[model samples]
Target: MARLPVNHPARPIYRVLSGLVGLYILVFGVWGTVLTWGEPPFARDGAWALGLRANLAFALVSVIFGIVLIVGASRRGNLGHYMNLTAGVVFLVTSILMMSVLQTSANFLNFSMSTVIVSMLFGLILIGTGAYDKVGPEEHAEEARKHRFHPVAEVHRRR
Candidate 1:
């Protein structure tokens, strides 16, 4: 059971950042999709969009993911927290998985080193946003703040 901040002061900023990342992903996906139109889903034809190598398959997936992120960011509940966390992990894992097969035929996403780096960066950002975007009642928030530096004592007190 990990403890997270409640009603964090920087919540708005994190939400905005999350939205921006989603916008970038959406734009990249749309551009990539148009550029890779009429090509094979996994073609290695060297198409680039927003500095990331992409193919039809990857582009379509990005579109969906981007939409999800945007929706999550726009929400005013914990949905964004969960979504960001999940997206962050997914991005991180995908970057590593793709990087592993960078030069092999298994690189169906046509990922380049740049793509891996960007994905990793996005992952970390999303995770950070998720960490501090939780919302709760004022009382809970006050308790959280009081225990911010002594979580063990807080847990014991709760028990």
Candidate 2:
């Protein structure tokens, strides 16, 4: 396996991840609001998410966010990382709050143990991925790998 640069980040990968998550939410939103004609964006249809019921409103908001994330991530700028960080943090918070803040019986949304874990995991990933942007793009993983064990061929001494 090749080694990654100490600071180089896989920004494109992170961008795609955010976009994919958004796509998933978009699908869920459409599925949830099939016939209600937007009556409930956050409705709890008693559907299970990670073994817990999720709110319809969450789905609606998720779809909108999904579009935002996808667009942001696709761009080659700091905005992509910003969106990833934002979404990631929100998911992380929501997951933790669902499992801890809300009552266990309140399965109105999948704030269950499963969602808590999954959301937290994804949230952290997004956060980590976004961080690369602030560090500034360095060298590619392969390029760094090539130089991993190599040392400077020559050293110049200034008098």
Candidate 3:
């Protein structure tokens, strides 16, 4: 049985959008991993308590989410969508919480910018991808794969 109907309209858009989000996850994973070990920004900050808390919180969240997406994508192939959806929700919730915290802080805009950018961008991308996925057809995905120079599936010839 096909996973999606043949006439679905969102297949191509979903594939591309999700692919972009997957790329972003991979890139951010690498960036966060590198930052975790190197000379981190919080290291120089005199406010050790809040700085350490924020740094640890950010690192932990990134590591957890990154691992989820990477493992899901590599192992399950299509699970990246669910992983990204969850990640987007997490970003939105975290952004809201951080924004509330910033409301009473001195560096309100500066600190909030990172969370706002990350939340908004990821939310938009994931929602777009999800919307496309809702209309995507499995048959079209297969056809698109056939036309590609680098097909995703292993081609099996005559036995």
What Cα-based lDDT does every candidate model obtain? 0.93, 0.61, 0.49
Q: Which pairs clash in the backbone of model 3?
A: 11-136
Quick one: best TM-score, which candidate?
1
In model 1, the clashing pairs are none
Candidate 3 RMSD computed on C-alpha atoms after optimal superposition onto the true structure: 11.6
Candidate 3 Cα lDDT to native: 0.49
Q: How displaced is residue 38 in candidate 3, in Å? A: 6.8
Task: List, residue by residue over 1-159, the lDDT tens digit for candidate 3.
Answer: 224233236555555655555555555545544544454533322222212223333444555665565454443234655655666676677667666665454432234445556666766766555433432356676765555424333443322
- How many Å off is the CA of 146 in candidate 2? 16
Cα distance off (Å), candidate 3, residue 57? 4.4
Model 2 per-residue lDDT tens digits across residues 68-141? 86787677766766777787889888886787755655544434466577678878877876665433345554
Ranking by lDDT: 1, 2, 3
- What digit string (tens of lDDT, one per residue) describes model 1 on residues 48-97? 99899999999999998899999999999999999999999998999899
- Write down the lDDT that model 2 would get: 0.61
Output the better candidate (1/3) by TM-score: 1
